[model samples]
Target chain A: MRIADAGDPLMGQLVARYGAEEALAQVREGRLGPGFVAEIAARRGKPIDCERRLAAWRARLPYVDAEADLARGEELGARLVVPGDVEWPTQLDDLHHERPLGLWLHGSADLRFACLRSVSIVGSRAATPYGVHVAAELAAGLSEAGWTIVSGGAYGIDAAAHRGALAGVAETIAVLACGTDVAYPAGNHGLFEGMRARGLLVSECPPGVRPTRIRFLVRNRLIAALTRGTVVVEAAIRSGALSTAGHAVKLSRHVAAVPGPVTSGNSIGCHRLIRRAEAVCVTTTHEVIELMAAIGDDLSPEPRAPVLPRDRLDAESRSILEAVPSRSGAGPATIAVSAGVDLMTTLSHLGVLAAAGYVERTDHGWRLRRST
Target chain B: MRIADAGDPLMGQLVARYGAEEALAQVREGRLGPGFVAEIAARRGKPIDCERRLAAWRARLPYVDAEADLARGEELGARLVVPGDVEWPTQLDDLHHERPLGLWLHGSADLRFACLRSVSIVGSRAATPYGVHVAAELAAGLSEAGWTIVSGGAYGIDAAAHRGALAGVAETIAVLACGTDVAYPAGNHGLFEGMRARGLLVSECPPGVRPTRIRFLVRNRLIAALTRGTVVVEAAIRSGALSTAGHAVKLSRHVAAVPGPVTSGNSIGCHRLIRRAEAVCVTTTHEVIELMAAIGDDLSPEPRAPVLPRDRLDAESRSILEAVPSRSGAGPATIAVSAGVDLMTTLSHLGVLAAAGYVERTDHGWRLRRST
Candidate 1:
């Protein structure tokens, strides 16, 4: 928890080399390896006192109480899921050194199982009604199709997506920048309660830790890593939602954006992603599935036109039918001559066409069947 | 004019084999080549009497008067644009043997020159108001960008495109299924008149010929071939506009479709085209231009966000700016420690940041600039 916000490469390298327990012990004793002092100096472009840098870690050594933090989480019905826990999602490891040391999970659902087939729905907090509606509907449809929905529990599109998914059968996860027990926005307090009971509220921040601007940005990487893909519902050209999409791209996860009206300012980011070939343009659940699902598993059916009786006819039959008069009937021989077909073949086709209601027998001969 | 409606492979093959006049002479004199009967028989899957088929052509001999046809076209203020005419769009030859023998044109603008840099905008005739608005806006923008607009002279989207283009500085062409002298819809008479005065109305039919379903289908090929690309503004899944897109694809022309709300049935064809990779998804005039314009030419500037003073900062400067307090002031030494930079670098960047309106020196030290 102390190191959750420490994304520094130098600290990460030390933790990776000595392992967490030995690294923590070394940091407390101010003995962080033999060559680490020179490496930190090289990275910082200066050869200052390494002991001064280690002072910050020593200052918090007395307050580093793991038992108290775990008990506080247990009091809130949350659990600490470490790297080797059964409930820890393995996909987060794809972040390498940037991955959280531990995840604070608050929910009834098993996090790892739910995330095995999941997609994140994210967008701007100031989304228009069109975006909100689309996000909710898409989440509902995806949930109904048995896929989990993941998102940051912010306002606008995020809230709508969680609400929509909650109304469906599948679980939804909210990867928060603050502690799972804390509702930073306050407006989403009720929504957070609902998620705690039904799905999951996940965060790297320990109990009582509040969200900051930098935390929100860092939190986006978790949302992208936990899912099979990330869908940006509506975002401005410079929205933070684009940061999540960028994380998804870097993670090699499928990235898709929902297209809306060109006149809508909110759709510009989505359109830009599509135009740049950074994301696929997806409008429906089926299309999203087609992008994220295994190949040949969730292929959407081809767009089809309403079928007409005439569509079933073979080419030769269509030619013969064209020769049949619409209003007036003509003799078989006359129709054959106009159709440029042999009389016997034309006569056989006429009988078949008449039986199929494409034509009817008149006093003169066969004519097109008129709908009455 | 006599063979304008005869789009048969046999007739086209004969015209390619011999020149038009010589081919007509052979038909008139009943002197079709010695091997012609076998080829026709092989294509039709039967041996029929050749004389009976030639009789239809010979029967129209009295009505095939080139002088009268040319005079009628002149009376309507239209001109015959043969293959070699300077006003004929050579791009139409991309249709290969399916290309029309001649085009009847009525307008002030040069057809070939106008078509040199043009894009056709097509959609369903029963377009929604949203479709109509988008079509007009796209056409107007494209026209303002100096690209000529081409479309069928139908109601709804087609009429809106022409009207929008007319409102701009560029000419707009209406490629009609009927003769240039006839306005099939009657309701678009005013729109057609405006086009004839400022741009070209082109067709393969003679002066009095009316439009039929098949003629409309065949005419779409001309519109697709006469432009650099085709943009379907809005369309139903089975729309005739898709046929135009298909023709454009067959001719290897750039095909683009504007995206709309998924809630709209009218946008189905456009979305399907994009999903199938049959068309590039275009949302703005610049995007359309980017698709049709040559590489390294007319490329749209990347989507930009409202710039902030901080956006221009270098990495070290951004770090220093982040360390600067938003509400309270901090000394340069304090900020340097927070920003992990040297005191000299922080002091230099703080001065530059102050000049750029990103920070202001305060009574204590320095704080972020507050917009008034």
Candidate 2:
């Protein structure tokens, strides 16, 4: 299962069956269970012979040099956490379509705990002074409120967020698109090094991986998935910071956008987001804190309010309620499919439940009546 | 009756009753009815005799010498229009509580036409280049769409708005708080002169009156009343442009505010207005034009949609419809008072109307359904 054991016979079988890219895509898609990727390769007609692929994989190891890089990372006191590890954040499981294969972590803080109360602070690299000041204030306030800060290790708003968090006695996490050891933007070397020393620097890419535009966009998903919310301090209409907001929304995480002067292009994206109602308008740290608090317990499966008198329900009603996902706000058809019942049965039960105040229809869809 | 006939016996009567300051206040409030001072004086104690006050008023006449100044303005081809004159703008009638006494005018554009189709464009005097550019574009677009631009003849956004409007086929109007013969800022003399030539420069005070803080605020009412809408491009929270917006709202004119970056203090006032629902968010000339079109036929006594249906109605229904104002939305109690019927009768009719789909209840109150 470890990437280190390239010479193991099973590695050849896995690669031959799934092909390298397809296998990686499957793993990212969460469809390739542990030890099952080889089955997919056989189905694809590759019929990978484990022994031969393993030999070829070993022969190419010297040039790939992943083992040596892993050794170096471990020597530097960093831990490698793969997808199935206990410390892996479950919230990140939301990125089911584009999940990372593994993460390189260099820090002391528990990644899961860090993510539970974390918020990503992102903005344009060429941020104005007002943007920087507002970003720093937001970071400091969130950190002081017992939340972990998350950001890129670049200059401008990113560096400010990390610095603000450090100032508040709380550490931050820097998620880089490139390798953990390399700082792509040379000007941000000091900030990258500072984060590694006192906070955490994480990357899905192997050591020595160079930063690319595509990688930056891909990295946005990780930042969005690893936090409770994303706060965009300032961004031009075409700035990549909006990518993080887009991913945050897809993952159903809270996205808070700051407002700026309509005259400034830097704030155009944020204003557009507010106007479209894709993000809540946040002018101060207090609003950000309130948004976080509202969604704070959303990740858990614990009843948001309480089980709405389900004990007195009939079998059909109980089945329909049970079929509803804790947070997905399921409709009657989806509930029926999940409950293995016909649509009519589900609808009838839902109608009764609704009439009895056991469930309610909301703008979001339908859900058990929390007020009940 | 006329200011020039100082030797008339009515002059003594005016001085005996009104004095100078009281008369000016009454004039500013638009309550100086014709011959009011003469009638009041005639009603007061014994035979009215005011030789001393008349002499003082005549001496003070030099300071209020609008006629002498008018000769200079006339030499410049400008005319003055006092309140109640045939050519006076009817829109100014909206300033019931803070009306101006008169307007000094320059240019051939009809005052009434300009007022009916005008939109006041105001912003910070120390506007940024972006603000100035947006103001110009907005003004030009509005003018091209047949809107007459109205603004204070100052620097930054105001100057840009006038210039942009002049560039288009539709001319603009400048309302100055200073005398029509004087440019208050001094630096804008060129703009002032250009406006006088191609557009119009108007003032409430007489030709020689100097600009003061009080006059500037009072002058805002003219800009607000003379326009169908007001667009605030940029303003700090306490900027005087907001006063114009207040007047626009009071005059029942459409208030459209442009959104800006929240980080910029210049946009904070506009943002607050939008948030409070005092102004609709507008980003382009089309939106402004649409808003104006939506508020068409401004003088129609019944501009609002009727709330109730008349088809298949009885005496109670007719009574209810009669009780409702053609313009103002009314509740049961107010309807009862206006209909001279009991509260229960009004409520009963409202219930029938609601059931018949003639009226709709809303969170604010109630409104007539658009269709019967």
Candidate 3:
């Protein structure tokens, strides 16, 4: 038996209301598909029809109003992306029944494309200065090399990671435990704004939802599944970063840890992971790229001339490209001021230039693509 | 084809005069046994009989003055320990043809027994304060656990190791590049005297010899081979400590490294060793012992009641034992004054008490063995 496509849009709402997992398990186990909920509702008096469950589920629908949630999401410039959507990252399909009922995306970069070249860098919220520095530098390096940096986007190492990616002019993704509209920590509101401008803010929860402790752990699996690998920069033995690493390990994805002084309590988890051979000890961006690309010919995609043809780009893209330095990249704000374009227009043109391969990100910021 | 042990002991002096390494290869490769040297002397007219080499070898011997060198060693209260002697550490046999013909020693500890359970800790002569602290603390921990600490007798990390072992009252052997009596650095004069009273100061070079750059490197193999394992505390990428770790690896002995800040130059070699899987990463003395002891019931040698019988000890040993506090160990000088014995006598009795397991070294000083 297969889940029917017709029931999905409404069923998706019902599932979201009940939090997809338990309802999906029932639908799967009973071979109920397509019109299952309606069939159960119609066969209410039958013992096998889940009559009482259907009533309880229907009673909750008045509280949901799927169309209104969808309309509100649209109003916020966010979208409810269900299975089979073109923008959906097929990687999530690996989770099978546990896949989100739908993702709530609130930014411009294409989710699938951004994650095609991405890694998740996460660590402790109470990170030390050294940890923050390492996380930022490592994320910046990976970003400069064209990999999107994905993180939980709360504070400390996570905030540093997202900010570093933005500084590199590479798309950064924040897969939050709360709604895309809500920056849970509030401390990272500014960082969230920067990401939404040039990167993405994503979540499984719909609009207006708040984060909980269990939600963060559930969110970690999404962070791990969204990227090619996970790098734990600095984490105490009990840090939440370990949950993401654990998920990555279980999913058979690449897992690595940046080593720090054995004296630092913040580095205990990373050291322990390395000591037990659970994670590769990585100290540089190149090492991390190597770990993720071990079985591929991609080889961290060596620096080479840009792939986009010059004749195809628009005048604005050329202007933005000309404003960008060939090395030691410039930020969008600086580039916009230098290029005589407004920041929003300059950002849109820069995005086009990046996608067209006419420009690239570096640890510093955006730069023209490597010269032919 | 065995190396003929019957070669003249004076011929041994002649062999030693040129150093056995380069010239002995010809003697070994030729498969010549006993009387081969005499036959070479009788067949001196033949070109390949090594006539010129032997003449040069014999010429250097008059300068050696074997009897005088022996007497000077005796005057220094030293003894000659050849391979077959009961005092020779059998681990040195792993060096094969490269092994020293004999070792010169000036100390009280039994060379063989002291090394029966030992680890060599060595690193840069220009070690940072972190390196010194790590080296000293590591050595003390091992000493307290009843493992002898072996090291080179140079400045910096080496000096710190020996002093820490002495403080623990656990024997520490200093394998010198020059004659044991010379104390090449001279700065460690006091340290040498302390070790000589309770540990061992050893060298392959005979009396009247001074240290040279080549001698220290050749000496490193002996230090590496003398112990159950070698731990490089901190070293530059090209520091001589790596040579000892390499020798340990080649001998199939366990090799470990104490990790430190990667930003520090002193820890580069250790990090490199760990990166290349050439050594196990160890942060504590117990981990070192674990790597060295993979089999048998010696699993960290579980803490238990002292094995030494109290009734069997001699009167002086009893006095020294009684003088050693049960906690917060006492120094030999202080213990000597308290036990009513001379310093030298107190050290001798302490060594006996340590060997019998009635006492053990702690980072601070000698302490009564764990009771119950």
Candidate 4:
């Protein structure tokens, strides 16, 4: 069966099985199989089999002609990498329930390689001159320090990051929430084209798809996942750029924010982030590089340091320690319940463990020391 | 001898014995004795103390008419208070080397009472709207919290601080560099008059002494010495307000600064201070209050907490700790020499001490823990 025809049967089956939103989620997560369409159709009260639906859906497939679009992308010296492609970035998998169906990419460097050292630089679309200058300086510095710059292909801070990265030898990538072939803002057409040539332009949707607010929101995760860190240069309390920072932090990436004057409304979000300790305050290029160095590889699978020393720990202490995630550093009470231990024993064990350097108290709670 | 004549003879002899500047310094430090006139005449250089020269100098005594000035000050309901007066603020003793001769005071509040919880609010004469707003808000809040606002009687931030404090129940104090009867700017005549009526207008110079640039520079120390803390709201890199902050720091008073956008020249000095760790960044009245509470009484003679613990330290560690000031943290080599131990031993001791919680490693260096 043709690819589009094959996809249609699964689409309807998926819709029937999990409803529209769930079906879309399944497709985005690449979980929809060949029989998915049939199952969806059955669930939707449509008793059509996959083959019959395939023929009808094939008529609508012209709007999503991946083969023809690939040819056009090839002509532009770009490539369309799907979810299973070797060049596809696995970090993007962090989106889990909101993963993209495919990615349209244009660049010399593989998307996977870029994602390894990438950091998203985002801020206000209506940036002040100070914001723009800081953004450009940060982008240039990070790019020169071997970080791949990731940003939205929009005006203001995003465009400045792309421009700054282009000034450096390292590559930059612009991830659009819109179609690969379309630059949504139009004003950033030049910057988008430059990114396509010297860096990369990526999009989740197929060619000719229009941009939507929901798409933009969903797209933030992709940027976050494709980076080891995210730096918010300037943002108002409600700026959309903060969404990217949230996603980065959620994905366990380093989040750094630049502080501006307390009087500047544009810096309110950055200040709040720093104040709440959600993000570290960084002022210089070197500090950003240092934070990135400290975070290191995001894909490394090594288990985090233990919250307590295993050798010195007693049964109760061991049980409590085992109950807490090594990285989370949960409190004694949480660990006690998780370990099925009594609270008094847990507290005594914790105190002794802490005194013996077997565990450390963190801002959150008690945590095992990695070293004895 | 009449009070004027006696005082004049003493003043002339003081100028001859100690030189004008040194005599002023002595007077300011309250080191001059009751027999100050006779002592000055006795110590006067013979070359300049000829009988004829002594008569000539004594002839100039009528020109040193502070009592006449006191009479005029009384006419304005402003009292002249000397250093030994019961109502003198003991905190002014902090200006060991740069003390003021005497203070010309106006208003109903006792000078000592007004200085009890005083905090100087100073900044650039050219204040931004944001700066002015923040200064006014801080002044009003601090005044409401029972902090006597002290500031130079200048335009912009200073004027705003005075006005804000005056609007609250607590009276503010204006520490003029000029005479109490003299309004330097002339344009602030109404403000000066109001200050004399409700708030206190204080100056080091007796009546009829014209305001001079050098005197203003010297006067900043009085403001610093009289207050328990100093808040710099907004200042350019070279602002005179920074001089007050410097004096406050030197006097070991709590120095707080408001942070502004790095791009704003007006905030550069405050930011620099925060970055240097010389001043804590305070955003609100509550923060200032908390800082003051943390600082405690300024007049207390007891030393504050020892920056590092000594008894629990090893010989090497003790040497290193001794080398470092109690307030400032220590580095390795300095600790090594002070402990009379080799560098390697010092390092090892430091490692052990750090592990045992006898010392804490900070961003700058290792600091001795105040308690075991």
TM-score top scorer: 1
lDDT of 1 by residue, B1-372 (tens): 464252445566677778788888888787787787788689779985766546645645655678888999999899988778888788877887788888889999999999988999999999999889999998999899999999998998999999999988899999998888886789999999999988989888888877766678889999899999999999998898999999999999999998888888899999889877899988888888988988889987777999965567686687778778888899997777666666776789989888888899989889988871
* C-alpha positional error of residue A125 in candidate 2 after TM-score superposition, expressed in Å: 3.8
The local distance difference test score of model 1 is: 0.84
How well is each residue in A310-360 modelled by candidate 1, as lDDT tens digits?
A: 778885587678768888889987666555555777889999988888889
Best candidate, DockQ: 1
- lDDT at B329 for candidate 2? 67
Off by over 4 Å in 2: A1-73, A80-90, A93-102, A126-147, A182-187, A206-213, A258-265, A280-372, B1-104, B115-117, B126-146, B167-169, B206-212, B249-267, B274-372
The CAPRI category of model 2 is incorrect
DockQ of 1: 0.36
What is the CAPRI rating of model 3's predicted complex? incorrect
True contacts kept of each: 0.32, 0.17, 0.10, 0.09
Candidate 3 residues lying further than 4 Å off, grouped into runs, are: A1-62, A294-372, B1-59, B294-372
Residue B6, model 2, lDDT: 15
lDDT of 3 by residue, A209-307 (tens): 667555687789889888999999888877889899998898787898877766677887886777777788776677788788647644443222234
TM-score of chain B of each: 0.83, 0.64, 0.68, 0.64
lDDT of 2 at A52: 36
Candidate 2's residue-wise lDDT over A204-286, tens digit each?
76666666555677788888999989999898877778999999999998998887655567777786676566887676666
Lowest-scoring 10 consecutive residues by lDDT in candidate 3 chain B?
A: B1-10
What TM-score would candidate 4 get against the native?
0.54
